[model samples]
Structure formats: structure tokens, C-alpha cells
Target chain A: MGFAIDKIRADFPILLRQVHNKPLIYFDNAATSQKPQQVIDALVHYYTYQNANIHRGVHALSQEATDAYERARDLVKTFFNARLREEIIFTAGTTHSINLVAHGFRSWLQPKDEIIVGQAEHHSNIVPWQMACALTGAVLKVLPIDENGQLQLETLKSLLGPQTKLVVVNHVSNALGTINPIETIIEMAHGHGVQVLVDGAQASSHISVDVQALDVDYYITSAHKMCGPTGVGMLYGKKELLEALPPYQGGGEMIKEVYFEGTTYAGLPHKFEAGTPNIAGGIGFGAAIEYLNTIGLEEIAAYEHELLMHATQGLKQIEGLKIYGDITHKTAVVSFNIGQLHPYDVGTLLDRMGIAVRTGQHCTQPVMDFYGIPGTVRASFAFYNTKEEIDIMIKGVQRAVNMLQ
Target chain B: MIIEAQQEIIEEFALFDDWMDKYEHLIGLGKTLPLIDPQFKTDQYIIKGCQSKVWLRAEQQDGRVYFWADSDAIITKGIVSVLIRAFSGLSAQDIVNAPTDFIKEIGLNDHLSPTRANGLVSMIKQMKLYATAFAAQNNA
Candidate 1:
């Protein structure tokens, strides 16, 4: 089925606003997407009716909260096609999710145990692993990407040795919108007896995911990336692997028993969740998943793919615009630098025209270092984004170049 | 149509005119930052979400409030200069009553990335909280 832009745009309220006397053209989807009415309404419904601490009380309000929270978990499991809801853990978004894995999985690590990550990985994915390796006497091995921002598999194969314990890769590059060949990555990692974790923060919104079919041991996603609440996210693990790992933080609801001498931890997902959770966020996330499911992932992906093509063609026509991450089989993220213009300056100028595109490194500094540039102005798209918006973005970029040049 | 925060901030550019020269003098003033000892950059004093290495030291001289900020980066030093000019030597009520209009006044917010602005807000809030504590201590 093809994408239906008109129908999709109708669902997002913010797409209709104006900026600087011009219609608002929101192209910064990779940073965070606009929440649909269903998700917003879900948050409102949650706070208005089911507002209580979850998983710890027998009161009616607690029961409602707990049920809603678990239902969100079930929705996530279904969204990712995981085998069990217990395998999914709630988190404060992708950054926190990755940090929890780093902290919790530290016990299993050893000196010189190689942890492979990609050069294009976000700071969240890179820094935590760097800290984990630094703390645990492990070595961080990087799989380099070529000029186009796609990983060189032959180089990656050379880097993957017997000592490689874990391979963490982004399923989609947020800066470049490069849809990585994760299936191949998982297969290769498994061949070397290495566990793999995929940062699906970008991919969860654009692609359909099936954890069972991919055979990935761990996958992390942020709900805000997929039109859900800002503070809520999920970490999917194989049940056996999660059950064996240690708890990330010590607090209420994450433990089954506590005492001065000894304490026992809660099962699987709960072990990672410490203190009071974002109860409203979880329900909102579930609503976001339901909303996406209704539209169909295939429909969204196909429409966005077309938008990417249109955007690429439009962006290509602009002079002095050097596009980053030109992958043929990528999603809808287009990052580019206008010659002689600082990204911050360009972003400011674009704001004057009501064009919202992300500037700076997009939080991928290593990638910026590789390119030997400060940063790029990134215009990422969603299913609701129209070709007309890209035209506006292109005109804005041209104006920026002319004004600054 | 939304007026870019940049326009609002830029409108009050005169407040920070020659801010660079003033910033240099501020750093020179920072050299006179009171002695609390040299070993205060421990993990306890570290503030999260800063791009530059910053160390904040708070002290009181009789009735007035004084702050000492040292950063490894030049722009960060400039930022500290702006903060010092805005809040230093004020009475506790003055410190508490001072509006964040200074950011817009100097166009500092216009030049800053959103994250950097947030970090700046955190720093200002922390300084204000410190002032509040000093006020409480004196009252007691």
C-alpha cells in the first residue's frame, strides 16, 4: 500500500501552525516527532482518570495504573513481535536504556573483552560503552563507515575477533538516515559468539521490527522518536539474558526483598525499573503504538521513502549544498552542510522562515570528526511531511547560503 | 507567526555591547576569586550537562554574595563573566529578585544552542539556590 499524506497530516495538529509569518515546516523528525492526537489524548486521559503509583498497591487507583502500565508493556511486545511481555523493560528513553544495559551488564565483562560499536553511533550509544569499557577493563572497537556513512562490512569483519563480547550498532543512523543492514550484522555477530544490541531509536518509527525473526539479543527504542511521550522508552532483551543480568539501580519496585544483610531482586523487567515510573508516559506510548499499528508500518515507511526521494532531489538542486549520508536504501533523514555557513547560523536563519531543521552534530560527534566539519543542518521527515515542505526547506537553505555567502 | 527568540534577544543587544572587553576584565576579576582551597573540582562539585569544564565556588564577604567561576574554555569564561556581572555583589533579595531578562538583554540566548541555554539556566538556577541557602543561613 502507498502512503496517504493527506490522511496522515490530518492526524498531527502542529503541522498546521505558522512561523515567522510563514507556515511551519517541521522537518526535524529524527530528533523527535510530533505527537498525534491519539497519543496526546492518551496522556490527557491517563492524568485525568488513571493517575497513581503502579505495581505496588492494592487500591483501585493503583490497580488501574498497574494494568495500564502492563498493557503498555504488552503493546510494546506486540509492536516488536517479541515472544513475551516480560522481556520488555521501561526506561527514561534510549540514553537511559543504553546506560542501564552498560551498568547492569558490567559484571559479565572482563579485561580486554572487545565491545564493537559503529563510528556513526550517537553519543548515547558511544559514551556509555566507552565508560563501561573504561570501568570494566574492556576495549571499545569501532566499525568504521565509509564516506557515504554506511559501514564497511569487510572492515567490520576484520575487527570482529573471538574476543569481541558484545556488538552494539544503530539500526538506523539518526544523522544520515542510513538504514543499516541489521540482519546481516546480527548473523555475523552470532557467528562469532558475540551478543548484539541494536539502538532502534530511529528505526522504531520508520521500520517494522520483529525481534524473534532478527534474533537480536537486545534492542532499545525511544517512544518520543515514534510520536509518543518524551520520558518513556523500552529495552527489549531475550528473557533468559535479562533474567541473568544484575539490576541497574537500587530502589523500590525493582526488588522483591530487602534487608540489612541481603536483598533479592525483582524478576526481568522490574529489575531495571527503579523508583516511580512515568505512568502516564507508558500509557501514552501504548496509544502511540496502537495509532501506528492502525495506519500500518508498511504504509508509513513507504510514504516516508517517497518523501526522502523527493527531498533528496530537491536538495540536490541547491548550489553549495553538500549532502551527508547519501545512501540509496536509506530512510527519510537528509543532513547537509551549506558551504561557508555555520550550522547554528543556518538554523537561526531557517527559524526566521518557519523551517525547523536540526543543526549541529545531531549528537554524533565521532561522525562529525570523521567528516572534519563542525556540523550539518539536518532536515528529517515523517509520513505526515509533504513534498511542499521540502520545497520550503530548500528555499530556506538557498536563502541562508545567499545571505551568509 | 512565531517571533524567533533570537529576534527578542537581539533587540536588547546594547546591554552587552563591548561585552568582549568587559568579559576580559571579568576574567581578570575572577583571578581575585577568593581562596576556598584548590581541591574543589571533585565529583561532588561537578554539574551535569556542560560542554566545558566548569568549577563553581560560592562564598560570602560580610553581607554581600560573591561567586567564583573558572572554566577551561574561553566562551565558558565569557559566560561566567556575564553571570558575574548579572548576579555578583547583590544582596540576597536582589539576587533572588533579578530577572533572567539579562539573557535577552545581552543576546546571549540568541547565540546559544538550546542545550547550552538549558545548561546556562541550570547554572543560573544553581547560583540562585546557593544564594537562597546563604540567606537562610544568615537568618538562622
Candidate 2:
């Protein structure tokens, strides 16, 4: 891989711009990755040339539209190494994908069914399952994380038993950037006859996912997190499992036949995709995946890992700063707070220098509760980010701390 | 400002939607937020829970309550803007009795995310507590 940082930076138009009279140093990749020119072009191409309703049209435009949509699905199928294209269902995003499974996976969910989740899982993953368990009268069990913010795998294993029907785990902790041992998680759960659903929202862009290799029953991810358009994502389930689960929503295109007597639903993926979806979004998503593949995920991940390590070391030199989520073997997210200065204050000063970072709980309130703090100033990275950007971020935080002190 | 003008401003609080839209002008109505006085950054007034540097000042005028908040962060300033809109010119009783649902109705929380919503709630609570004290003094 070239690791051509300049070329990669050039591909993103927004990175070239300035904020606050300073060149933009976007460190908010964990919030959403910037789109490459190719992805944006693909979006333009879809809306410009091949715009039409998908799946059921007999016209030429319809066939073209259907091909583009199916092609995106096939790309995702290969991207994740899903067993079949039919097992992949398009969703609005990771939140919707997880909610679908949480609500529709009621088939095997009995009263008192035990569900296991990690304390570090994003609220999107935790809240839905919590609500589901509350509604179903099932038990919501948590797999606690150690001080370093890594999941306690042994504890997770001990928590799972015969009563455990579904296990929800994040492929990567969005807040702490901990790469979970999902393969072990899946194997252990399956041995106890439990299904695992992995939240791949934060992991999909940074790591290569093979649903077959991991043997997870369900996997969900957001396209926006990976440089694709928002409001588009995919849910991958084992063919049998997807077939067994009921449709999450009912509307046009998810039916083979509908009568007052009864309704016969469409098979597999379409059964879940009711109504007109983000056709342009699906095309743009494929484009984003293609863009990521060309750069190579391993190369990006390796470079970002190096960046995080370097930034952590550099940031340590600054005084009165407490870095949150300082776990080894983490991804590119660095969260911290300066002594006596709020993370919001820290963030505001950083923003004035055209350094964009996410501040606050990052939607993982449990992690905040665990740390006994309300929030942190989170600087997340991506392939396009550089060492220089991290330097600027560090300087900004230091200045804020100094002025406040 | 003139007493009649202040009275008109106080009357506008009863019509919340109008107050919300015109909050920025009202904040400009004060002594321009004092350049945020960098000396106030000590540990004493530091809000432990917030991600931004939110400094709050509550004032009383003719039995009514007002708040002036400034944040170093932009979105947090926008949040403070909304808080001032919701709470300024109202009495302590009205401030306490006012529902959080008004925030949802304006779709203020839409531009903000869930985590930001939590911070905004905290900010609003702090403001209401100050209002409660003012209301208590007036009642006494």
C-alpha cells in the first residue's frame, strides 16, 4: 500500500478548507468519515443518470436502478463475506439495523431470556436491547469492562448460560476504541445455543469484517461511519436466522401477495426492506466501500493505530491533562479532559483554532458513569489524518488548560 | 433601559415562542457578556459535568429573574442561547413550572444530539435552581 497521505487528503474536498482562519484539521472521523471524491461522484452519477425505483419496475430505467441497488448489496456481501446476498438487508443506518433485530428477533426471545451486552457499547446498542428486554420481560445482563476500558471476556463468558438467548456486542467500542474479541464471543455464545449480533458501526471502516469467519448470527453497520452517505446501512444475518425473524416493518415491496384474508411476504432481504429505500444512498455506499478497499483497510488501520499511539505519547507531555480511555490495542479515538477545565471548554478553544473534535459522553453514558465524569473531549482519527493535525490538537488543548489555570 | 421597555420585555415571557425567536437580541440587551473574563477559569466555578466552559450568571430585576451564560464552545453557546430564550424574563415560579417539552417542540434538540441534550438539560437545571432562589427571596 502506498500510504499516500497527501493524495488521500486531496481526495476529500472538505479537508482543504479552513475553519476559524486556520486550515481544517478534522479529528471527528468516529462521528462520520469524510467522503472521498469518488463516493460523492457516485452519488451524483446515481441521481443524474440512473435514478428510478428499484426491485419491481419493468422499464429500462427500472432495470438499471435495480442493477445498481443489487450491485451495492453484492459488494456488501463480499465486503463482509456474508453467506448470501439475500441475507443482506438495507437499513437507514446502524441504529435502525440494530432496532430491527432487537424488535424482530422476538422469535426465540422467551420470558426471562438472558441478553448480554458490554458496558462500553454505544447507547444505540445498549438502549434498544434494554428497552427490548424490558418489554419482553427478559433479563438485560451487562459484561463489565476493566479500568483500561477493555471488556472482561471471562466475566462475559461466565454471564452467558442456558438462559442466554441473544448476545449483543460491539465489534469496536466507539468511545474507547477497544477492538473486542468478537470471534471468541461468537464461538462461546453459540456453544450455549445463543445468537450473537455485532454492532460493527465503528469497526467496519477500520477493520475487515467476515461474518462467515466470525460466525455471528447478525451484523449491523452504518454507511456514514465509513464515508458513505447517511441514512444507509446494512444488516447481515445468517440466511436461516433472517428467514425465521419477522419483518420489522410492513409496507410496499416486501410482499409477494397481500389480501384481506392474509399476506404472503417476500423472501429474505426484501422481507425486511419495506417501502422505497435510499437508492442513491445505497449506490453511494458501494462507492464508499470501493474507495476504502482501494486504500486498503489494513493499511489505514495500521497508520491510524500508529497515529493514536504517537498522539497519546505527545499529549502526555502536556500538564494538567487527564486522558480518558487510555487502553493499549485501541483504535484512533483519544478522549481526555484538562484539570479544572471542562471538556466543553477544552473543545471550544480547540474549535477556535479550526480543530474539530467531538466532546462529551460520545453517547456512551455508561462509560462516563464508570469514570465518574460527565464527559470528555474526544479526538477521533481516520486514514487521511496526519501527525501534524494531532500536534495542533495537542497545542490547542494545552493552551486551553493554561488559560483556564 | 426605561421601566416601560423593561415591562414590555417582561410581558414577552408569557409568549414563549416569541421570546425564543428574539432571545439573541435580548442578550444583546445586556452589557455584552463581558468578554467572558478569562480570570473566571479557576476550579471554583468549573462545572464538573459539562464538556464545554459554561459560566452562568443569574440576575434579578423587579421581582423577575434573568440568566446570562457564555460558553467557549459554539454549539454550547447555541445551547445557552436556547436556555436564555426559555428561561429569561420569567419569574422563578414560571421557570420551575415550565416543562422541558417546550425544548422538544422548538426542535432545538434536533440540531443537538442526545448527549448534547443531556448537557442542555444540566444547564437548564442549573438555571432553574438560581431561579428558585430568586423566587424564594421574593416569596419571603
Candidate 3:
């Protein structure tokens, strides 16, 4: 079925907001998506009516909150199609999730053991692995990308060997919007008996993720990027693998028994979920997943692909404007620069026109260094975004270029 | 006279109701900013904590400090130009003592983004550091 974009746009209250006396044309979905009224209402519902801590609470409100919280975990597990609900661990976000995994792997990884990360990784994915390598004495390797901003799979094949302990790569490049060949990468890594962690921070919103089909050892994504609240995310791991890894943090929920002499940790997901979780955030994240399912990921992907095509065509018409990344297999993210004008200047001008676009290296400084540019103006789209909005943005960029030049 | 200069800037910003017009004015100011020497664009003169690369140089002549600055981003360059216009060709002590309330009076600080605000703060800090350095040299 064709996606009903206008009706979907109405679901978000922030779309009605005006910036600088003009209608807000938000194109920064890669950074964070606008929450639907349903998701916001879920948060309010949790706080107002079902406000209580989970797990240990004996009260009805506590049980209700616990039920909702655990149900949210089920939603995430189902969303990613994991084998067991116990495999899904709620986290502070993608960064926290990756760091948690890295922390767990620190003791397991040996000196001279290799961990491969892509050149186009967000700092979240790169820095944690770097720290993990530093702690374990493991050597860090790079998976190089070609001129088109796609990962060089041939090089990745060569990089994978007996020494390679893990492979970490983003499912979609947040900076470039390139959809990586994760399925293939996973297959290759598995063949080498290596673990693979797919950073799905940018992919969850635009595509459907099946952890079972891909069989990735670890999959990390943030709720905020997928129309959910901030400070909440999930990490999907194989149940055996998660059970094998030690507890990431020492806390109340993560403990099976507490003893001053020695401590035994909780099993599976609980062992990793340390401390008081973002209870409200998890409930809201569940609501967000429900919201996305209503529209369907396949439908959203198709609609966004249409938007990408239209935007690419419209933006290419502007002279001296250069679009980065391989457009063939990418999300609806257009990262570009016009002539000699700085991205910040163009972004500033766009803001005046009531358009919100990201203008910076986007936490992928290594990618910027590869391109030999400081940054590009990134305008990423979602299912709710319209063709008319793209048209307005193209015109706005043209006007900005004219004014700046 | 310095306060009067700030007032003039406030009045100048007041002429534009629309942010677009104000930005256009800023761009015009940026275009007219006196170019810094290529040698001065080195890492030593560059201001840290800015999203944009900003190079600032201070030259003391006749016991007065003249500030020259440049930025890769036009809006940032424009912002730097405004600061230079307010502080340049003044005595080191005078530059140090000059009120930065004009940034608020003109609503530039409020209107600027968080990153740009940080940049603005860093720019002001760099200028003040230069003023203090020059003041110490003269006193010594």
C-alpha cells in the first residue's frame, strides 16, 4: 500500500511549528526524529498514571510499570526479530550499548587480536573499539571505503583472518547515508569464526532489521533516531554470547545475589541492564515501535526512497553543488556543499528560511578527513517528509548559494 | 565612544525585522572584513572550540591594539567582523575594559546557535587574551 505521508505528518505536533515566521522544514532525521503524538502521549501516560520503578516493586503501580517496561523489551526483541526476548538489552543509547559490549569484550580479547572498524564509522562506534583495543592490547584495523563512500568488501575480506576477533561496522553511514552490505559482511565474518557488531543507529528508522536472518553477534541502535525518546536504546546479541560475557556494570537489577565476599550476576539481559533504567523512555520507545509498525518499515523505506530520488534530482539541478556518497544504495540523506561556500554559512541561510539541516562533520571526523573537507550540509528525510518540502529546500539552497556567492 | 559604537550596532540590527535580512547584513559585513595575512592563518593564531576554523591576529601599534580575524564560514566571519569592528584600534586596556553587552543588545548572542555561541565566546576570549598579552608587554 502507498504510504499516507500527509496524514502521517499530522501525527507529529512539531511539524506545525514555525521557525523564523516560516513553517519548520526539518531534514535532520539522521540526528534525531520528531516524535509522534502517540509516542509523546505514551511518555505522559507512563509518568502521570504508571509512574513507578520496575523489577523489585511489590505494589500494583510497580508491577504495571515493570510489565510495561518488560513489554517494551519484548517489542524491541520482536522489532529486531531476535530468537529470545532475553537477548535484547535496554541501554542509554547506541553509544552506551556499543561501549557496554566493548567493555564486556575487553577481558575476552587477547593481545595482538584484531578488531576491524570501518573508516566511515561514527565516533560512537570507533572510540569504544579503540578503547577496547587499548585495554586488551588488541590491534585495531580499518575497513576502507572506496571513492563512492561504500565499504571496500574485497579489502574487508583480506582484513578478516584468524587474528580478527570482531568486526564493527555501521549498517548505514550516518554521515554519508550509505547502506552497507551487512548481510554479506556478516556471512564473511561468520565464515572466519569472527563476531560482528552492526551499528544500526541510522538504519532502524529507514529499514527493517532481522537479527536472526543476518545472524549478527551484536546489533546496536538508539530509540531517539527511530521516533522514540532520547536516553534509550537497545543492543541485540545472541543469547549464548550475552550469557557468556560478564556483567558490564555492578548494580541493583543486574545482581542475582549480593555478597560482600563474592557476587553472582543476573542472567542474560538483566545482567547488562544495570541501575535504574529509563523506565519512561522504554515505554515511549515501545510506543514508537508500535507507531512505526502501523506505517510498516517496507512502506516507509519505499516512500523515503522516492523522496531521496526527488531530492537528488532537484539538488543536482543547482550549479556548483556537489552531493557526497553513492546515491545508488543509500538512505534519504543528502550531504552536499555549494561551490566554495562553507556548510555552516549555507546551513545558517537555510535556517533563516526555516529549514533545519545539520552542518558539520556529524561526529564522523575521519570520514571528513577522508573527503578532505571540513563538513557538508546534511538534509536527511523521513517518511513524513513531503515532495513539496524537498522542492522548498532545493529552492532555499539555490537562494543560499546565490546570496553567498 | 565605544558604548556609542555598540549602540550603533544595535541600531543597525534593529533595521531588519526578518532574520534573512539580518543575515544578509552580516554577510555584507563579512565580505568587507579586512583580510588577514596568509602567515597569520597558521595554527598558532587559530581560535579553538569553534565549529568553524577562525584565525585571529592582534597587532599593537602606537600603544593601541588592532585585531584582524578570518573564518572559513561566512556567518562566523561576519560574527568575527562585528567583534573586530567593536574592539580594533583601541588601547589594550580599553579593549579589555570594553563592554561585550553589545552582543546581547544586538540579539546576536541569543540568535546564534549553541555551537556558534561557543565560537563567539572563544573569539571574545582570544581577543581578550591578546589584549592582556599586549598590555603585559607594554607594562614590562
lDDT against true structure, model 2: 0.81
Candidate 2 C-alpha lDDT tens digits along B35-128: 3355755565444455656777778898677776666554466556656765677777888776665554444443345455327767777887
| lDDT tens digits, residue span A1-405, model 3 | 567877999999999999978999999999999999999999999999999989988999999999999999999989999999999999999999999999999988999999999999999999999999888899999999888799999999899999999999999999989999999999999999999999999999899999999999999999999999999999999999999987788888998998899989998789999899999999999999999999999999999999999999999999988998946689999999888888988887888899999999999999999989989999999998999999999999998988887
Model 3: colliding residue pairs: none
The candidate maximizing DockQ is: 3
Order the candidates by TM-score, highest first: 3, 2, 1
Q: What is the lDDT of residue A218 in candidate 2?
A: 93
lDDT score, residue A382, model 1? 89
**What residue pairs clash in candidate 1, if any at all?**
none
User: For candidate 1, what is the DockQ?
Assistant: 0.05
Candidate 1: what lDDT? 0.82
Which sections of candidate 2 miss by over 4 Å?
B2-140
Off by over 4 Å in 1: B1-140
The lowest-lDDT stretch of 10 consecutive residues in candidate 3 chain A is A1-10
Give the per-residue Cα lDDT of candidate 3 at A267: 86
- Encode model 2's per-residue lDDT on A139-193: one tens digit a residue: 8999998888888889977898989988898998888788888999899888888
Q: How many collisions per candidate?
A: 0, 5, 0
- Tens-digit lDDT track of model 1 for B27-53: 353454443345886656555556444
User: How far off is model 2, as Cα RMSD?
Assistant: 7.9
